[model samples]
Target chain A: MSERRFPWEAVLAFIFGAALGLAYAWVLAPVQVIDSAPEALRAEFKDQYRAAIAASYAANGNLTRAQSRLALLNDADAYQSLSAQAQQLLAAGQTRESQQVAQLASALQGLAPTVAPSTPTVPIAATSTQAQDPNAAATSTPIETETPLPFYTATARPTHTLIPTPGKPFELGTQENVCDESIGEGLLQITVQLTSRRQLPGIELILSWSGGEEHFFTGLKPELGNGYADFNMTSGVFYTLRAAEGGAVVPALTAPVCPAANGGTFFGGIRIVLQRP
Target chain B: MKRWVWILPALVIGTALGLLYGWVVDPIEFTDLTPETLRADYRADYILMVAEAYQSEKDADLAARRLAIFGSDSPAEIAASALPFGRENGFSASEISALETLVAALRAWQPASGAAP
Candidate 1:
């Protein structure tokens, strides 16, 4: 019998090819993605930093805690960014939110003195200074009484102190009685009407339920005629609507039991009418 | 040993051929993608999606859980770090803005301990 020769040459060839191939693939011919650092990305980081500060403020309601959390970024850009956001909010007529954001921005500025303060359209610094002065009580009186709602009777309409514009105030006629009615199968549509049967416009209202509150301006839908708004409520859920600007509470309206209608609409709802007393 | 001398030639010839193929010929070009790079690309999108979900669902616990995929750090930290990484990786201005908005929303939504959802 002839002795079988070992195929060592083939084995060696295979190993050599594999090794070379792997080396070339891994070291020489491999594709690479060039990494880049963008200025916009830096801006984004700054934005996130501000957002984080705002969120911390919202959660803890502690300026110190939020400031401590902001210390991690160690970037002074937070001041400029947050100051800009506050300005934007103020321009949009969100006074309360703008003040809150401005406070956060001021906190960031305190943390980083190296950063120059950005100019705010609103008198943030002046307002803050006035707030801190013990003897400025007379000047601060208007701010303390700037409630969104004030009491009004049928014979006398409350002055609109919370109007965003300086000269234009809301012309609130009077409080009318709300009519309890159901429409569109089981859907509850709360229609705010005047004694003249015209739909009320530009009235801010708050709807409060078990665990949540929603604020909305009326007259959003022209077809709904300025006074029509709808809310989804569970049967037996008690909800209250209050005039955000006048502080008058609509009689507590409970979701009424309604026969099952098309599209799962709930019926037996109440209609609210605000009339002059 | 003499008969096996062919192995030397074979090895040299095969290695030369493989090197030629890999270097100048039809070489396999593998993309050098690391986990960090992948995360850099997807991080902004992920944060925005999480924020939208949080807005609709208002579930902070779930947002925290989903945001944990980036790391063990707080969602704010992860988002803060990701802003730079995402920008370096070519995230658009709108995308970055969206991410920023979401981070803020998430921070605002974080409930106190034992608070109701």
Candidate 2:
């Protein structure tokens, strides 16, 4: 055999080709695929965009910034869509939340005219006399009617006001007595009587015992008067009474002693007076 | 024939090296993902972030809208789906509980028919 010849060039070519292939396969190809793959759902992106707008609105209370962010959705009918959502929420009986959504929709609607029109200058009347003249008002009726009619109609619908209901204030010098008495042998009756004797329709009393609670609202028993309410307590059990409004506890009279069962009849009938604090 | 014999070994070695680099040494990670993936654990973290944002903003509608993107039919379902993932991912107990409360609020806001049973 002739002196052995080494194919160094072929070996080098093979190494180079292998490195290129590896780089292409490992680094380039997968990166391209990842870059092309859909990252998030359209709905998800919309939600995120809305969240960002809300956050910006909250941070600065800036309607302009919020509207600018909302415009990113590129939906010309975004306000209408929000309004529809609000209506749907209302139909679902989510009144509070529906009102909130409706407000956002209205805000977006308010921003539309300011954002869309390129003309920055407002039209000025030729003379102040035109604004004051009755003849001018009569002549401009058509234009005025055209523009303000929609504004009036839009404002006519009462926006739901989320005012917190105030707690009923007790009249000064008002006093009430809650008494428990034995009606007959082994029977007891509890009664509430007001010194002013004004029967407030909404005042409520809640009585809690060992494992139960009962509510006594005024006017539930018309005979009890507006401020008058009562509940019979089970003998041999301790109970606490509290005045309440819409589930909120208010200051009320507490029984001085827990009613006790006496072999045949109940004992410990006590009367306590509640005064306006 | 003898000169061409080197071709087979070179081809084999080159292919082996390429595969080694591609699969082991410099392999690409297709699984590396952005927040857009919305994976279970990622979604749990996102919901927590939204909740924190809501606490300061106090915007219920915005919160509900953000949550709806998860594609759950109801907030209860979303809570149910996220609770385990959140727990597994080491989310705080308070965060998990707040999510439950949020679910209840959202459920209350949902229509009776749309609410989770």
Top of the candidates by TM-score: 2
After superposition, candidate 2 runs with Cα above 4 Å error: A6-277, B1-9, B19-40, B55-60, B68-79, B111-117
What is the per-residue lDDT of model 2 for residues A8-75, given as tens digits with 9 covering 90 to 100? 76787688769776866776663332221112325435545454444433322335434543553444
Judging by DockQ against the true structure, name the best candidate.
Answer: 1
Per-residue lDDT tens digits for candidate 1, residues A1-277, read 9687888767777687767765865577553433311111344443443453454353223344345334433445655555565555544665444444555664443321111122221112221200011111123321122222211112221211222221122233343222234343224455555445655433456789889787754444436665555665556767777755453466456766544436453446554555322
Candidate 1 global TM-score: 0.26
Candidate 1 DockQ, CA atoms: 0.10
Question: For residues B1-117, what per-residue lDDT tens digits would candidate 2 score against the true structure?
Answer: 577777767866786788777877866754323334543443554465455334344455556666666664564566456677666644444445546655665666645344323
TM-score of 2: 0.31
What is the C-alpha DockQ of each candidate?
A: 0.10, 0.09
Residue A23's lDDT in candidate 1 = 84
RMSD of 2: 23.3
Backbone clashes in candidate 2 total 3
**After superposition, candidate 1 runs with Cα above 4 Å error:** A1-11, A15-277, B1-9, B12-39, B55-58, B85-94, B105-117
Clashes of 1: 12
